[model samples]
Target chain A: MRRLGAALWFAVHTAGQNFRRNLGVSLAGVFTMGLILFLVGGALLFTHSVDSVLQAQQAKASRIKIYLSDSASLASIMDFQLRLKNDPRVISVTFENKDQAAREAAQNPDIQAALNALGSNPLPASLNLNVRQLTDLGQFDSMARNTPIVDKTTATDYNPDVIGKLRTVISVISLVGGIIALILLVISLVIIMNTIRTAVYARRTEIEIMKLVGATDWFVRWPFILEGVIGGLLAAVFSGGIVFLGYKLFVQAAQRSLLSVPFDASYSAALLFLLVLGGVAVGAFGSYLGVRRFLSV
Target chain B: MSVALAERPIMSPAPALRPVISFHGVTKVYPNGTTALRDVNLAVHQGDFCFLVGASGAGKSTLVRLLIREETASTGRIFIDGHEITRMPHRKLPKLRRKFGIVFQDYKLLNTRTVAQNVAFALQVTRPGQRHLREKVEEVLWIVGLEDKLDKYPDELSGGEQQRVAIARALVHRPRIFLADEPTGNLDPDTSWGIVQLLLQINHRGTTVLMATHNREVVDLVRRRVIAIEDGRVIRDEAQGSYLREGEATI
Candidate 1:
C-alpha cells in the first residue's frame, strides 16, 4: 500500500512538473494531435455516411418479375409458381392472372381505353417472385431458368447492377478512409515525438543532474511521459468536442431539414461512440508513440 | 580478480564503532573499457569528515559513484551499513540515494525553477506534502544564508550564490550521508572557504561528509580527514587539524 501510494504520488508530481514547465510545447503538441485526429475522424464520418446508402441497397436486394406471354396457360404459370416456391432461393411467389392484370390496368384511365379496344385481354398471366437477399438474386435467377414452366424471369424490385456499383463505391470509400486514418495517426505520433524531444533537449542538463543524484530511469522518464499524456488529453478533448458538435449539426440539418430518407435512423448513438473512440484512440496513440520514441522506462 | 584485489591497496586499520561505508575490493570498468577503480578497499566511519584528493583520472569520482550506487562495482562488492551496495539494482538506488545528499560541481540547478523550487525538488520528488516541502525548503535556504533569494532563478544568481543554493538543495532532505564531488572546483578562493566552512559545520552535526576536491588551499583551511589518491590508488590518508594554517595553504 505504501509503495502504491509512493508510485502514484511520484507520477502526480511528475505530471504537475511537466505541465508547469513545458506548457507551451505541450499545448502545441495537443493542437497538432487534435488536427490529426480530426482529419481521421472526418474521413470516418464521410465513409460511414456514404456507406449507409450501399448498406440499404444490399439489404433489400431481391424480388422477381414474370414476363407476360399472351399464349401461356394459367395452369402452366401456376405450376411454375409452385416450382419457385419449392426452390430454397425463393421466399414467396404470387401469380397475377390476365383478368387481375386487366382490372389493375383499368385503374389507369390512360391505359383503360386502349385495353377496351382489344377483342380479348392481350396481356398474359404472370407470377411475381421475391427472394430473401439481394446477393441471392444470382442464385434465384439461375434457379428460375431451370424451372421448366418459367419462360423468362425479371427482377422488378431490386437492381443487382446498381447494388454491385454501390458496393464498389463504398469499398473504395472504406479503403480510402482506412489509408487516411493511418496517415493522420502517423502525423499525430510524429508531432508528439518532436514535442517531447524538444522538452528533453531543453532539460538535458537538469536530467543529467537528476542522474547524478541517483534518479532512476523511471524518474528521468516521468516528466517526458507526463508531457505526452497532457498533450494527448487536450487533443482528446478538442477532437471529441468537434466531432460531437459536427455530428449534432449534421443530424439536425441533414436528417430533419435537408436530406431525410437516408438518415431516418438515429445516428446520435453512432456519433457518440465515434467521438469518444476517436478521442481516446488519438490520445492513447499519441502518448504511446511519443513515449516510445523519447523514454526508456 | 582476487589476486589483483590482494595486490592493490585501499584497506586501512579502521576503528569499528560504526561504519557508514565499507568497500571490499570494489572496481569499476566502464563500458568504453576504462578501469576507474582497481580494487578499492576503504571504510568511512560515521561522522567522519573525509576528503578524497586526487589529480584528474585518479578514481575519486568513481569511488563516490560506487558509494551512492550511481555505478555498481564491476569486480567486487561494497557495503553501506553492512548491506551490499555494489549489487544494488536501479529500482533500489533512488531510495538508497534518498538517504544521501549530493553536491555537484556544476551546481546542477534546474534553470526553469526558482531557487526555492529547486531546493524543494529533492523532497518533492520524494513526495512530501506541500506544507512540509515549503517548510523544509525555507529552513534549508536560511541555513545556507539565502532565505531572501528564494524566488531568484539560477541564472540570476552569482557563482558563489549558485553554489550555496546547490548546497541548500543537497542538505534539505537531512540525509545521513553527504557526498560532494568537487563542490569547490568552480568557486573563487573566498567563496571556496565559505563552502568548506559550511560543510564542516554540517559535519559537526553528525552527518558523514565525504568531499572530493583538487583544491589544496581549501582542504588545508578547514582541517578534516583528507584521503589522497594517485593513479587509481590511495597514497595518503591524513588528519588535517594541525598540519597546515589558513594563509599558508595555496592552490
Candidate 2:
C-alpha cells in the first residue's frame, strides 16, 4: 500500500518537475507532436474536401454524347435514348432538338454570330446522357460510341484531363503527408526518450543516496517514471491546442474560399480527441521507455 | 530545546532482549572469487547500541550490506527476527529492510529534494497514507530538530544538517532497529558526537543501533556495547548501559 501510494505521488511529482526543469525540450516535443497531428488532420480534411467537391458537382454524365447525322430522323433519336437508358450503367438520357441547339448557341456571343450568319437552325439534334458512376472511363466512352444513335457520339467539353490531373495531385499530396507524419511521430518519440534519459543522468547521485538510505530499487525508480509522464502530458496538451486552432482556421478558410465545394469543418471533437490521445500516449510511452532503459537492473 | 542528555557520571546497561539481528557463520564470496567475508558470526540484541569496528576490507561493508538486504551472503545463514535470510528472495527484501534504518558516512540525503522532502520521501516511498506520511515526516524532523529547515534543500545545509536529514529519513519510518555504516566518517569530532548523541537518544527509546566505525574516542567515550571486528570475525561484544525509554542516558 505504501509503495503504491509512493508510486502515485512520485509519478505526479516527478512529471511536474520534469516539465518545469526541461521547458525548452518540452516545448520542442510539443511542437513536433502538434505539427505531426496537424499534418495528419490536414491531409484528412483535404481528402474529405476532394470527395465532397466531387460528390457535389453532380454524377458523371454518360461517357458518350451522341450527335445525329444530318439525315437521321426524330424516331431514331427516341430509339437511341430508350436503348441507352436500359443499359446497366446508364442513368438517364435527354434528346435535344436542332432548335434547342440553336437556342443554346445563340446565348454564346461567338456561336450566336455564326448561327445568325447561317440565318437558320441548321445544326443536328443531340442526346445528353448521365451515368451512375465513373467506372472504366475508357469503356464508358466506347459504350457511348456504340449506342447506335445513327451518327457520331463523342465525349463533350467536360475536360477529363483536368480531373485526372487533380486526382493525381491529391494522391501525391496524401502520400507525402502520410510519410511526413510517420517520420515526425518517430522523431517526437526519440526526442521524448532522450529528454527522459538526460533527466535520469542528472538524478543519478540522488538515486545512489536513496540506495544508501535503504530505499528499495522500486522506490528509487518511480519518481523518474513520473517525471517522464508529466513531460509527455504537457507536450501533448500544448500540441493539441495548436492543432485545434490551426485546423479550425484551415477549415474556415476552406469554407470561405471554396463556397462551391462543400466541406464539413465541424469535426472539432475528433480533432481534440486525437490531440489528447496523442499527448497521453507519447508521455506514458516515453516515460516507460526512459525508465526501462536508464534504470536497467 | 528537548532535554539534552546530561553528562553521565556512569551509564547503565540495557536489558538483553531477543537478538534483533543474528548472523550464523556467514560467508560471502564475490563473483570474482574475492572472499569478502568468511565464517563470521555475530548477534545484535534489541535496545543494545553496538558498534562494529574494523579496517576498510574487514567485511564491515559486506556484512552491513547483508544486514540491509543489499547483498546476500554466500555460505552462512542469517536471521532478522529469527527468520532465515541466507537464501531470502529479493521481493521479500523491502519488508526486511523496513525493519531497520541504515545510515551511511556520506549522509546520503537526496540533494534534489528539500530536507522535508528527503525525510518525507521514506514514508512516501513506503506508500503510507498521505496524512500519516505528513505527520510522520513532521514528527521525525521535530525529533531531529530540523522542523524550521524543512524547506531548505540538501545542498543548502551543512554536513551535520545533511546527516541530520539522513538520520531523520532513517528514523522517520521508526524501524525496529538502526544500522549505521561509518555514519561519522565524513564529519569532524564535534559533529560526530552530536550524531552519536542522536543515536544514543534513539537507542534510549528501545530501538537497537548497530553502527560500524573506527572512531576510537566515540567507542571509548560513549562506552555502550562495543563490538570490534577484524578479518571477518567478532573480537568483542560488551553491554555497558541500561536502556531508557525516553530520558537522558542512564546507560
Candidate 3:
C-alpha cells in the first residue's frame, strides 16, 4: 500500500515537473488539442442546429391542402378529415370551412380583391394535412385527387419540386457535416500523437537512465501518461468553455436574424462531455504510443 | 576530492565456486552484419574485479549490453547469479537488471536534478516507499565522496563530481554486480584513477565489478584480472594481467 502511494506520488510529481520543464512544447500540445476540440464541438453543434431548423422547415413543407367541392356536405368533409387523420403517414388533419377560407384569403389583398369581384364565397372548404414524411406528400396528394368530395378544378396544393429540393438540401448538409467531423477527428488524433511524441523525445535521456537503473516499464511510463491525461483535461475544459459560449452566441445571432435556431442546452452539455472524454482518451493513448518506442532499451 | 589509491582496503582472494556472471560461447551479430562478439566464454565470480580492455568497437560495449540484457546474444547462453538471462522474457528484464549497476562514459546524470534527487531516483523507481530515502542517498553520495554536494545540480559540478554523482546513483541500490563501460574515457588520468579507486572500494564491499576501458595505464597499474578483446574475440584471459601480455605486440 505504501509502495503504491509512493509510486503514485512519484508519477504525479514527475508529471507536474515534466509539464513545467517542457512548458513550451506542453502548451503547444494543449493549444492544438484545444483548437481541435473546439472545432469538433462547434461543428457538431452547428450540424445539430441546422438539422433542427431543416426539420422545422421540412414539417412546414410536408403539408397538403385538399380543396373540397362547394356541394360537399359538412358531415362528409368531417368524415374525410377523420379518415385522413387515421392514416399512419399523416400527423394531423384540419377542416377549414368556406367562411374560414375566405377569412384567411382576406388577409391577402389580391385574393380579397379577386373574391370581391366574384361577389360570392368562391373559396372552397379545404382539408389541411400534416404528414410524417415529405416523400409521402405525393401519395397523399394523389389520394386526395381520387376522393369524390375533393374539388376537381384545383387538386391538393402539394408542390413536388419544392419538397424534393428541401429534402436534397437537408441530406447534403448532413453529409457535409458528417464528413467534416470525421476529418477533424482524424486530424486531431494524428496531431495529438505527433505532439506527444515530441514531448517524449525531449525526455528520452531521462527514460534511458530510468531503464538503465532497473525501473519497470510501467514505472517510467506513468509520469508521461499522467502528463498526457492532465494536458488532455486542460485542453477539454478550455475548448468546451469556448464551444459553449460560441454556440450561445451563434444561436442568439441566428435568432436575431430570420432563422429560429434553438439553444439545446442538454445536447450542448452532452457534446461537451463527449469532447472532454475524447480529449483525455486521445492524450493518454498518444502518450502511451510515444513512450513505447523508447522503452525497448 | 583527491584520494590515495594505495591506501585502499585489502580484497579477498578466494573465488566463489558459482560465478555470479558467466558466458558460454556468446556471440552477437547485429542486423547490419557487424559481428560484435564471437564465441566469448568467461566467468566472473563474486567480489571479483576484472578489467575488460579492448580497442573501440572491440565488443567491450556489447559485452556490457548483453549482461544487462540491453541486447540479446545472437547465439550461446549467459547466466547472472546462476540464472540464464539470454532467453529470459522481457517482463523479467527489470528484475534481472536490478542485479547490476552500470555507468557510462558520459556520466549520464540528470542535469536537471540535484545530486540527492539523482541518486534517490533509482530507489524511487525500483523500490518505492523505501524508508529513509534521504539518508540512503546521503550514504551513497558519501561512498562516492560527494556527501556535501547533495543539493548541487550536475551542471554546477565539475566533470569529476558529475561522474561521482552518476556513481552514487548506480550504487544507491547496492547492486550485486557493477558494470562500468568506458567510465574514465572522458576524464584525465588523475580523475580516472580516483574513479577506479572508488570502483575498487565498491568491489572491496563484496560486489563484483567489471570495467570496460581503453586506458592501458590504469589497466597496467591495477594489474588485476584482464580480458583483452581483439577483433570480436577474447584473445587473452589473465588472472593477474596488464593491458598487454608479457612480451606481446600492441593489444
Pick the winner on lDDT between candidates 1 and 3: 3
Candidate 1 segments exceeding 4 Å error: A1-17, A59-61, A68-132, A152-160, A205-226, A241-297, B1-18, B241-251
Query: Which candidate do you rate higher for lDDT, 1 or 2?
Result: 1
TM-score for each of the candidates: 0.80, 0.74, 0.95
**Candidate 2 positional error at B60, Å:** 3.4
Instruction: Please give the clash total of every predicted structure, in order.
Output: 0, 12, 0
Q: Candidate 1's residue-wise lDDT over A80-188, tens digit each? A: 6777799786788888877997898789997798887865786656677777766777776666566555554432334678767777887898999889988877776
Give me the runs in candidate 2 sitting further than 4 Å from their true place: A1-108, A118-133, A153-166, A203-234, A244-263, A293-297, B1-50, B57-59, B71-79, B82-93, B110-114, B130-135, B145-156, B220-251
Q: What is the TM-score of chain B alone in each candidate?
A: 0.87, 0.86, 0.92
| Local distance difference test values of all predictions, in order | 0.73, 0.70, 0.90
**Ranking under DockQ, best-scoring first?**
3, 1, 2
Model 1, range B109-188, lDDT digits (tens) per residue?
98888999898777666544445568888989998889999999999998889999998988887888899999989889
Q: After superposition, how far is residue B167 of candidate 2 from its true place, in Å?
A: 1.0
Per-residue lDDT for B57-117 in model 3, tens only?
9999999999999999999888888788888999899999899899999998888989999
Deviating ranges (above 4 Å) for candidate 3: B1-16, B249-251
| Residue range with the least summed lDDT across 10 consecutive positions in model 2 chain B | B6-15
Colliding pairs, model 1: none
Ranking by TM-score: 3, 1, 2
